[model samples]
Target chain A: MEIFMKHFIRAVLVLVFLILQSTFCQFIKIWDIMPNLVLAYIISLALTSDDIMYAGGFGFAAGLLWDITWGRVFGVRTLLFMYIAILAYRAGEYVYRKNISVCVIFTLVGAVITESIFFAANFILTHNASFWQSFFRTIVPSAAYTAAFQLVIYNLCLKISKMGKERSSSV
Target chain B: MNFFKSKLFIVLAIVTVIIVAFMILSAAFGFGTGPVSNGLNIITTPVQNGIYGIGKGISSFFEGIGKSGQYKGLYDESQKRVTELEAEVREIDTLKNENDRLRALLDFEEREKDKKLVAAQVAASSPDNWYAEIQLNKGTNSGIRKDNVVYTDNGLVGYVTEVGPTWCKVLTVLDINASVGCVVPRSGDTAVAEGDAELAQNSECSMNYISKDATVIVGDSVETSGLGSIYPAGILIGKISSITPELQGLYNKATIKTSVDFKSLREVVVIVG
Candidate 1:
């Protein structure tokens, strides 16, 4: 029951961030580009949490919800985020996951790769845009913007990760 | 002792196959309004809209405070202008009566009398900037359908792309995938207004495929040609801000400064069929 509660709280947080990503985040756009809040949450959770399956499951659910609510194509973000969670989980093992700088770097790299893949697919299929233009102009700037927010998100997830541990140790 | 044969790798591969299949099915079958989307909409739409309202309220409170002093000065200036506008109103009223009589003689109908409009507030924006789309609070229940034209008091906004039970998504005029048939009213030359990635960054779109010999110029008004069935004719698209020769020199392309301020677009009207 405790484990179920932990996962349930994580799911709720995912939905909250997903909502902010679409609604409140718009008001804070820097030059028409908003930070990827949902991606930052997924990265932070994957880094701080020890359970890979939970990170992957939450990431999948967030991506599926985002696609259904806001994305033009379904399953695109779902696939990308699932792989991103796994990669972040594996990378977190080699480094000190609790370090804020490491968490920020992970978010930066993850956001860049995600945006690049999404833009490339859009360019290849549509042929209506210039790859280099969107890459330098929007994708890079958006990744940096998302990375800047990882500082706050990482701390938040770190607390959640410790919540379960602290209670278990107390018991 | 091989990574390729690991359970993790096998699981990842299976997930990949399943997601790719889902992507293909969604794209081919147009499952935008399928059961999954509908279910999610039912759960999330009200919550999203409520959060948006709260956010807007907080922001407006701060904005109102900041504009209080500015509004005071504007109010004083408006009082002075009101006297001048009162005289102009009397003259305009006389002219309007004369114009009405002339229109009756010519048997002309009002331009906007036929279209029905439904008002909707913007509930949210696209999660990523790759596409310029917004969610409206109204949906199929509000008589919105795919390709229904959206506009503001200022000008044309975009068309509805996907509709749920209580919400719908609109692809704005600045989206790369959006295109509209437009015409330069002064020259009567038809052109296609299309969204460009580079130009959309500046909140602008491109008017392409203008005839080489056409007398199109900057500052000319552009409106829908009514050539497309989606948008009605004479709906204002924007004004041509600049015209430049195409790279191949075969035609000309004009940049349009849309009249609608998409950045602060809080409300819009959907043309209900």
Candidate 2:
């Protein structure tokens, strides 16, 4: 019952972030580029959670929803989100993920990996001549923008998790 | 709680994501089931649309404040064009009446246009996409189908690539994968407008295959030629921003300043057929 409650709340949080990612991100765009808030949210939760699978499940569900919502191809983001989860967990294990400095680095690196892979997929699928041009101009900047937001989102998720723990223990 | 941190959990998650992904991949590639996916879309599109509308409102708030000065020049130019177009429309209306009279005398059977314009809100666009594609609130239920032309009050946006029950995806003209049939109205020379990777990053595309002797110049308006059965004729595409100075053959090329301001673009009108 406890485990169910925890995962349930986490899933709800992930869904909220997904909604904000698709909706709010469009409005606060920097130079026609909005940061990937969903990616950041998933990565932040994974950094502290020992249950990578639950986080992975959250990511999978979120990615699948995004695919259905906006993606041109199906299952593309599922594979990519898995890669991000594995990378964030493995890298966080060795480094100081809770610290702001190292967390930003991890976020940036994770964003780069995810966005680069996505870019390559688009390039290969479309065979467009301007793939590299879009990569440097749009993809890279998007990574940076998303990394900047990871700071706030990561801390916020941790705080929420802590509060959930306190409430569950009191009950 | 500690059980979730176990190696078993990691393995379990990986397997689950992979399995689901494979199923969806197969569905996308082959052995697809449309009804299931369409059902999912029908469930979520309305909720997504509501959130998307709030997003647009917030975005408009910031953009209007920050970019008001930038739009001043565009506003003045559009006003001038509107006046000129009003006069042109009056002239065309008279000509249309005369043609109808002539056709009536000949007892010609008139054909219905078979076109419906569906107004929709822009649901969402990923920044990672650089506006390459946009999601629309209207979809197959609204008579939208794949390849339906998507445009705005200003000009051409792109084509509907994917359709759902209540939402559709549009591949914008800025995507390197997109191409449209267009022409310079002043010279009446036809050309193909294709997304250029470099220019698309800046929300522009270039026109290709103009006749070398074509009388196209800077600031000349380019519009859909309707040579292809896809888009309606004379729908405004953009203006020739710069003509390629040198040409290797009898054909010429130029860059177009797409009239659609994608950064501020929030609504679209899909031509449903």
Candidate 3:
């Protein structure tokens, strides 16, 4: 029951972020760039998670939900985020996962990677995209904006992860 | 330890292939509006609309407070002006203003009486910056359909891209994928108004393919030419902000400031038929 509760809490967190990203975040654009809160949450969750399957699964579910609700192309975010989770998980093995700075840095890297691939795929498929225009105007700035939230989301995920672990140990 | 041999690595590889295949199929067949997406939207649209309403309310509350002082100052100035003006002259001026405004509204209504328009509130905007689209609270249930034209009182917004049971997505005129057949009413020169990546960020688009020798100039009002079946004629799109020669001086391109203020867009009407 405790384990189920822990997973349930994480699922709820994903939904909240997804809703916030689609709705409230629209009103909070800074310099015409809204932070990708779901991406930030996925990266943070992946970093703090010990199991690769759990990290990948969470990422998959979050991306799938976002794609279904608001994405132009389905499966792109799902694949991108799932790969990002695994990459972050592998990177976490080498670094101290509890470090806030590490989380922030990883988020920055992860955001850039995700945005770059998305842009590339969009450009290839559409053939109407401008590389320099999108890169300077949107991609870099949006990555930084998404990374800014790493501090808060990472800590929240860490706290939740620790809480679940504590309950299991106490039991 | 060979990481490639790990069970988790193998599983991830298989998942990646499946997802990529799904993406290819979705892109090719326009599968983003399939059953899964519709089902999810049905479940999530209410939550999104509710949150959007709350956000709008909170924003409006702060905006109202900020504007109250400005309104107060305007009111005092208007009162002083009213005291200075002759009573008969003031009454005549107010009547003239009201008459002109009513006449304009009546003209627009008379012109659009044949079109079936469904009023909708914006439920949410696209989550990513890659697209400039918004979801409306009304969809197929409300007689809204894909490709239905959406607009505000000011001017053309865009058309519906996808529709679900209770919600629809509108790709605004500011989106890069959008294009409209436009004419400069003053010069009578027709042009194509297309969304630009750089200008869309500023809520602007570009009107292209104007004849180089056309007498079009700055501040010329551009409206739909009705050349295309999608957008009806004479719907005001925007005004020419700047004009520059394009295609080695063969044609001219003018930057247009869209009449509809996308940032403050809340309520819109969709031409269902």
Say which candidate scores most in DockQ: 3
What DockQ does model 2 achieve?
0.38
Give the winner by lDDT: 3
Q: TM-score: which candidate is best?
A: 3
Which segments of model 3 are wrong by more than 4 Å?
Answer: A124-128, B68-107, B247-249
TM match of model 2 to true structure: 0.77
Order by DockQ, highest first: 3, 1, 2
> Among all windows of ten consecutive residues in candidate 1 chain B, which has the lowest summed lDDT?
B104-113
Query: In candidate 2, what are the lDDT values of residues B1-273, reduced to their tens digit?
Result: 696897856776777677567756765684332776577656655676788777767767876587545545655779788667656866898899888767753442222235467889887665355447777888877899888999875788988887887878788888776778888878788999988656875678989888877888999999998877677787788888998855467788899999889767777778886
Worst 10 residues of 1 chain A by lDDT: A121-130
Question: After superposition, which runs of candidate 1 have C-alpha atoms over 4 Å from their true positions?
Answer: B57-111, B247-249
Cα lDDT of model 3 by residue, B1-273, tens digit: 798998987998998888888888888887658898788778778999999999999988988688545545545768766555545565887899899868866876787899898999988898888778899899899999889999876899999999999999998888877889999888799999988767877889989889988999899999999988798898899888998877676788889999888887888989987
Looking at candidate 3 chain B, the ten consecutive residues that score lowest on lDDT are B67-76
**Candidate models: Cα lDDT each:** 0.83, 0.74, 0.86
**Steric clash pairs (candidate 1):** none
Q: Give the runs in model 2 whose Cα sits over 4 Å from its true position.
A: A1-3, A128-132, A167-171, B1-36, B63-115, B211-213, B245-251
Report DockQ per prediction, comma-separated.
0.63, 0.38, 0.72
lDDT of 2 by residue, A1-171 (tens): 656666677777766776677667767766666788888887887786776666666667777766655555677777677667766776788887778667677778888788777777666566654566666777778888988997788788777557557756888
- Estimate, for each residue in A1-171, the C-alpha lDDT of model 1 and write its tens digit: 666776777889888998788888877878877899999999999998787877787778888888877766678898788889988998999998889999889998999998889887766677656777787888888889999998788888887777667777998
